[model samples]
Target: MYKKLAIMALCCLCFTDCSQASRSVSCQVITITDGDSLTCLLKNKKPLHVRLADIDAPEKNQPFGNKAKQFLAKLVYQKSVQLRILGNDPYQRTLAVVYNAQHENININMVKSGMAWAYTRYNRDPMYLNAQKQAMKARLGLWQDAHPIPPEQWRRKKRK
Candidate 1:
């Protein structure tokens, strides 16, 4: 009886850990504000502001900014996505790598398709970095300009 009890306890522990590791959080894409920012309706029916992890899109007034917005809209607007919430940013937006219902990685795809730049400051994903480099080589989207200002630099210049 003791051996059976021990086996049961072990099984329970393994089940608990597996469940925690593979848990899926559901969220609806309420709005796609731009390449980086969006509003999501979480499983609890609460609206959440989500920032795409590992990428930065141009601001509204910046070059290719409108194209970024349109690209994101085509990818996520009014669709349901899954967010593996890494944490929250300083701005209170949930910092997450979102995936579509089809299990496509939206953040990496944006970089690979030349719609956004890989934000290396907070992300160390080598695949994303390579994709961005490839996009630059191909002169995709924002890279079409001989010297396109990075979104971060553009924001700094505007502040001055």
Candidate 2:
């Protein structure tokens, strides 16, 4: 009886993680909306608007914005992507951390490459913060700007 109970518990634990991992959506990125967003076509012919989670890229008008977008495009456009859905943002876009076929985390790479800032308020991962710090130290991409303004602040200023 004890052996049977142990086996059941092990199965439950395995399925819990497996189910969450299996929830990932397989899709093709048809368009690069910006540095941190994309338009994808799911296998079921459904369209999903995805916003990269835990990172914020520059606004189109902001310095290095186009570079950020271009970088993202080079990484995923016209390629199959795996999206692990976290949730939706206020804008109703599905928030996800995208992965390439090689299993690389695209969102974190954006930070590591200095194309985007780790959205500190929403990102609790020390790896993300560490990547940002390293990028800043190396003066990559937007970090090259002596005073690069974050997208959040840039958007607020634009609103005003």
lDDT value for candidate 2? Answer: 0.88
Candidates' C-alpha lDDT: 0.82, 0.88
In the order shown, the candidates' Cα RMSDs to the true structure are 8.3, 6.8
lDDT tens digits, residue span 57-125, model 1: 888889999898899889999999998766566676777788998999999888877888898876788
Clashing pairs in 2: none
What TM-score does each of the candidates earn? 0.83, 0.86
Question: What's the alpha carbon RMSD for model 2?
Answer: 6.8
What value does the lDDT take at residue 12 in candidate 1? 53
> Which TM-score value belongs to model 1?
0.83
lDDT of 1 at 131: 92
- Best candidate, TM-score: 2
